[model samples]
Target: MSNDVFTPSRPAPGRTRFTTGPLPVLLASALWGTTGTAATYAPASAGALSIGAATMGFGGILLCLVAGRSALRVLRSAPVGLLLTGALSIAVYPLAFYSSMALAGVAVGTVVTLGSAPVFAAVVERVLDGVRLDGRWALAAAVTVGGGVLLITDGVQLGDAGGAVAGTLLGLLAGLSYAMYSWVAARILRGGRHGSRAVMGAMFGSAALVLLPVFAWTGGPLLSTGVGVAVTAYLAVVPMGLAYVLFGAGLRHTPVRVATTLSLLEPVVAALLGVFVVGERLGAMAWLGMAGIGIGLVLVLTRR
Candidate 1:
C-alpha cells in the first residue's frame, strides 16, 4: 500500500498552520521526551552508542516496512543529492547525539543539541530555500533557546574539560545534522510528489543501513538482559519510529524553523520525567526556565 494513506488532511478554514501544525510536532516531542529516561532503564552493559544505533536502526527498518513500496518509489524518484544528504544527516544524528551525552553531562548535551537546532534550521531555510526569518520567529527562537539553556543547565558538571569540549562540538554537529535532515525532508514534501511517510522511510531506511553496522559492533550488551532488550525495543518503536511518523506529519503543515522550535517541548517533558519518575530534583531556576519555554511556545503558536 502507498504511504499516502497516512498523509494528514489540510487545515480547515480560519485555522492557520501555526494553530494546526504544532499539535503533531508537540506530540512527537512528548514521545521523544521519554527517550532519556527510557535509556536509563537499559542495562549497564548497553553502551550509549549501541543504544543509539539499535534505536535508529530498528526504528528505521520499521518505518521502511510501514512505507513499503512508497518508500522504494521515493528512493527511485527523489533527487539523488537531496536523498543522500538527508540520509547521511539522519545517520550522523544518532551517533553524535549519543556520544555527546556520554562525554558531556546529559543536560549540557541535550541543551546544546536541541537548543542549537532551531537556529541551524533557520539558517538552512534562509540559505537554501531563500526564506526570510520574521521577527516573531526570531524572538520565539531566542526565548525558547534561552529557556532550554536555563532549564537544563542546573547542577550540570562537565567532568574532564577536554571531553566537554569534544562533546559540545559533537552536539553542534548533531544539531546541524538535525537541521539538514529536517530541511531536506521538508523540501521533498513541499515538492508535492512523495508522501511524508515515503520520504521519512526512504531517508531513514537508508540511514538504517549505515547505522546497523554500528549496532552490530556495539549492540551485544543489549542482549545481555531483559531490561536492556525491553528498553531498546521501546526506544526503537516509540520514540524513534512513531515519533518520527508524527514529526513527518507535522512537517507537512509546519515550516522547518517552527517545527524545530516546537520541538523545544521535548526537553521540558524530559525534565519533568526526570524529576517525577527518576527522582531527580530541579531548582527554582529550572522551574522558571520551564515557564520560559511555555511562554515561548505560546508565542510560536500564536497567529497574528
Candidate 2:
C-alpha cells in the first residue's frame, strides 16, 4: 500500500478506507484508556513526572528496537525539521498529560486533553496541509467534544481552584502537543517514503533521546517497588509502544481530524473504567455524555 495515505489528491476508496481504518485506532484508544488507572498502581514515591517519563522513554526505545533497520533508515532520510517537531511534541505530551491528571482529576484531565485534540488536529491540517474538513467531520468533532465536556463536568470533583486551573492549562498544552505530533506523523506517512512502523519508530525514538534525561532524573522511585516496576513496564509496553504502533497504522487510512475525533473513545473507555473498576460514580449527565459520544462516533463512521 502507498504510504502517501492522507493526500487530498489521492483519496482511497470509501468502503475500503472506512472498513480498514477505524478498528486499529479504536483498539489503540482502548489500550490508552488504561493508562490513568494503571498509574494509580505505581509506587507513591514515583511522581507523575517520573511515571510519564518512564512510560514514553522506555516505550519509545522499545518501538525503535522493534522497528529495527526501518526506523534507522527513516531517521536518516526523513526531514530533520519534521522529525524534530514530532519528537518535541511527543516529549511534551506525556509530561503534560500525567501532570494534568495529578493536578486535576483523572476524568477531568483526560477529557480535557483528548477533547481539545480534534480541534487542534483540524487546525493543524488546515494550516499545514490546506485540508478542509467536511461538515460531517466538523459535526462529529463538535458532538464528541461537547460530550467530553459533559462527561467531566459533574462526573468527578476537581481539586483546589489553582491546581485545577493549572492542570486544565497543562491539559490544553498536552492536547495541542498531541495534535502536532499526530499531524507530523500523518504528514510523514503521506510522503510515501516510509512505513507506519518506521515513521512511528523514528519519531518516538528521537523523542526517547530527549526524554532520557527526564527519566533518569525522575525514574529512580520506579525501581523502589515491584508494583511500580510492573506498572511502568505495562504502561511502556502496552499503551505507549503497542498502542502507538496501532495508532500510526490507523493514520495510514484515516485523516488526522477523523483520527483525533475517533480518539474520543479513549476518554469514554477511561470513564467506564473509572465507574466500574475504580468504583467512581457518574451522574445522569455523564451517562448522557457517553451516549452523545457514541452518537458522534456513529455519525463519523456512517459517513458516506
Candidate 3:
C-alpha cells in the first residue's frame, strides 16, 4: 500500500479528460464497490461498526501522514463550520454504510447507499450551492433511483423486517453523509488554498479522531481472529486509503453530481460480488433493478 496508486501521471496538454480524470474516479468507485464483498471474508466476530471505524480511523491517519504539512495547514486555517461538518459527515458515513450492508446484505445495502448519493448531491447543490439541475441529470436520477427501489423491494431478507427497515434508513443516512463530504471536498477545492489530497486528508483525519473511540470499543473482536485482522487491514489500506486518493483526482475534473452518479458502478460491482463471492441471490426483479441502474449510468455518462 503505497499512495503511488493515487498518483496519476501528468497528462499531456492535449490529453482527454477521461484519461486524466473520470477514469481514476471510476477506478476508485470500483475499488469501493469491493468493500462489502471483502468484508464477507472477515471473521464473524467482527462487528460492522468496528470494521467501518477501523477502515476510516486507521486509514484516515495514513492519509493524513501522506498529505503531510499542507494537510495540517489546511486543517488549521479552514473555516470551523466547514471543517466540523465535513468531519462529522465522514465519521458517520462508514458506520452507516457497513451496518446497512450487514443488515440488508451487500447488494441492497451498497445499491441504496451509493445509488442515493447522486440525488443527495443534486439537492445539496441546488439548495446550498445554488447550482441548477439539468434535465439530463434529473431524468437520469429518476431512472437510477427507480432501480434502487426495485433492489430494495426485491432484496433477499437478512434478519427480521425490523433489520431491513433499519438498514434502509441507515443507508439513506449514509448517502446523505457521503454527499455532504463530497460537497465539502469540492468546496475546499474551490477555495484554491488546499489541494485535493489536503482536503481529503483534513476531512478524514478529523473523522478518524471522532471514530477512534468507537474502533477501540468494537474492535476487540477484530483482534480475536487473524482473518478479521487481515480483512480489516485490507479495507483500511485499499478501499479507504488508496481509493480516496483516486477519488480526489477524479473530482478535479468531474462535478460532484456527475461524480457521484459515475460512482453508481459501485453498486453494480457490489452486486456482482454478492452473487459470485458471498453466495447471495438476486431475483429477477433485482436483476432488472440493476439493469435500470446500468442504463441510467450509461445515459448520464454519455451526456455531453
Tens-digit lDDT track of model 2 for 179-227: 9999999888878777788889889999999787998998888878889
Ranking by lDDT: 1, 2, 3
- Tens digits of lDDT, candidate 3, 190-245: 67567778888888999999898999999998868888889888998899999998
TM-score of 1: 0.95
Q: Residue 186 of model 3: what lDDT?
A: 77
Model 1 poorest 10 in a row by lDDT: 1-10
Per-candidate clashes come to: 0, 0, 0
TM-score of each: 0.95, 0.94, 0.90
Worst 10 residues of 2 by lDDT: 1-10
- Taken over the whole model, the C-alpha lDDT of each candidate is 0.89, 0.88, 0.83
Error of 3 at 254 (Å): 1.4
Best lDDT among the predictions, by candidate number: 1
Show the colliding residue pairs in model 1: none
How much does each candidate deviate from the true structure in C-alpha RMSD?
A: 1.9, 2.4, 3.6
Segments of candidate 2 deviating more than 4 angstroms: 1-15
